[model samples]
Target: MRNDRTIKWLILLIPTLTIGLWEYIRHAFLLPYLSMELGNLLAPFIVLAVTLTLVRSLFARLEQSQQALQREKGTNAALEERERLARELHDGISQSLFLLAVKLDVLDEMKIDGPVKELATGLRETVRVMHEDVRQAIANLRLPPSPAAAAWVVPLRELLGETAEMSEAQADFSWSIPDVSLSDKEKVELHACLREALINVRKHANATKVLVVGEADGFGGFRCAVEDDGKGFSGDPLQSPGRFGLRMVRDRATAMGWNFLAERRGDWTIVELRKQGGAAS
Candidate 1:
């Protein structure tokens, strides 16, 4: 409405100014000019052109603003939907799969053999993978407003002791930080990597001993190492065809902006990770 009023005022002013100038020129020079009928006919066309240009410009600006607002609303809606799906997967599907895996494991232990036992074990492993995938999805959906860091002293002695019992191997775990705090995200990623490393050791490492170590470096970073007496590989990691486990470790490390190294030295293979900044402690 304001734009329309301004255009109307401009259109009226232009004809008024033109007529005043024509009259001044006619009186001062004593010259004949076009008849008033011709001037009257051109005035309406001039006013129409001016009004159309102004209205077109105003509408263009309005259209641009509307488009920008719509784009912003669409982006916000996508983020909210992603968050909602992540929450549901974490709270509902993950718990259900975990419980199902537990039940299958119990059934497998009751002298089951052949296809049924194999199927049960496979189902349990499948559920475990799904659970991990859901957790990773949730982690990826998180936004940049990070949670506050807190310190917790992970009881390395107790934790490692339990892990050793479960692995049924001679566990040689060491740590320098008796008390250290890590961000929740970092802690989750680190734990997942550790679990994968241990599983690899148990499944492929044909040795009687495994060593796990965690330490804080002086340069505001942390390092972890998992070494096993396994049959080490000789080829390049990227060129290897049956190295999915190593690929997963490398991918997780890359996602967290950490450095990962896996190499063989004689009969032992070592997987080392270095996180570049202090997480919480």
Candidate 2:
């Protein structure tokens, strides 16, 4: 504020001072050599030019600073929204999903039969998959806004490590890219997709070892691969049991113009997410 007042004063004073000095010089010194008529006509124009030179630079700098401050405020607002969203998801959807899963578990164990039993079983699996989806959603909401690739990838790595440990699976994590050039939206989707993949490996893949890889896709994009040496299943990604997470990941990838593929390579089941034409926003 003080700086603003000073700038305002400077802006007002520059023209006044320029005109005053010009008048004084014309009367005191240049009047005798130059004609009075010429001085009168040129004084205001000279003052205007001088004041413009002085004010232009200041205005330019002020404009730049204002733009920078606006950008910072925008970033802060986005982060705050993320934090609020995370809290709401955890407190509302996550808890609700947990409760639903518990109810489904009870239903699964009940002495029911016929179509109802099969429906209950299917619902149980669906709730389990949805529970994992809610977890990944919560994680994504809680993730910090990362400007650098390293910062963004660290959370994903930690998530995989934690999931692997919980599943008692040995994880070999490798990241060849120091940073990724992806938009914030892309980063969140990528992280969520990777987390879901790892969760699938943890819960369903009865695998003893998992190899997680993150690297450039060699086409101006990035790729995340989660390969598990588990008992591979055969079926369509969308129609298989315990495969809802894969479907969600695939849908997000498709919506974002990325690529998602799940296949058995040799003895390992590999899930790969690729983002082509990666660029930061």
Best by TM-score: 2
Residue 116, candidate 1: alpha-carbon lDDT: 88
Which lDDT value does model 2 have at 112? 85
lDDT value, candidate 2, whole model: 0.79
Q: Where does candidate 1 stray beyond 4 Å? A: 1-168, 178-181, 237-239, 276-281
What is the lDDT for 46 in model 2? 95
lDDT for each of the candidates? Answer: 0.67, 0.79
User: Clash number for every model?
Assistant: 0, 0
lDDT by residue (173-246, candidate 2, tens digit) is: 89885354555687678777887888788778888888889887665787788899999778666679757889
**Model 1, residue 78: what's the lDDT?**
65
TM-score of 1: 0.43
For residue 213, what is the lDDT in candidate 2?
93
Candidate achieving the largest lDDT: 2
For candidate 1, write residues 32-123 as lDDT tens digits. Answer: 55565766676567656654776456556666666877877877886888789878987898788888878987897799789988888878
The true-versus-predicted C-alpha distance at residue 245 of model 1, in Å, is: 2.8
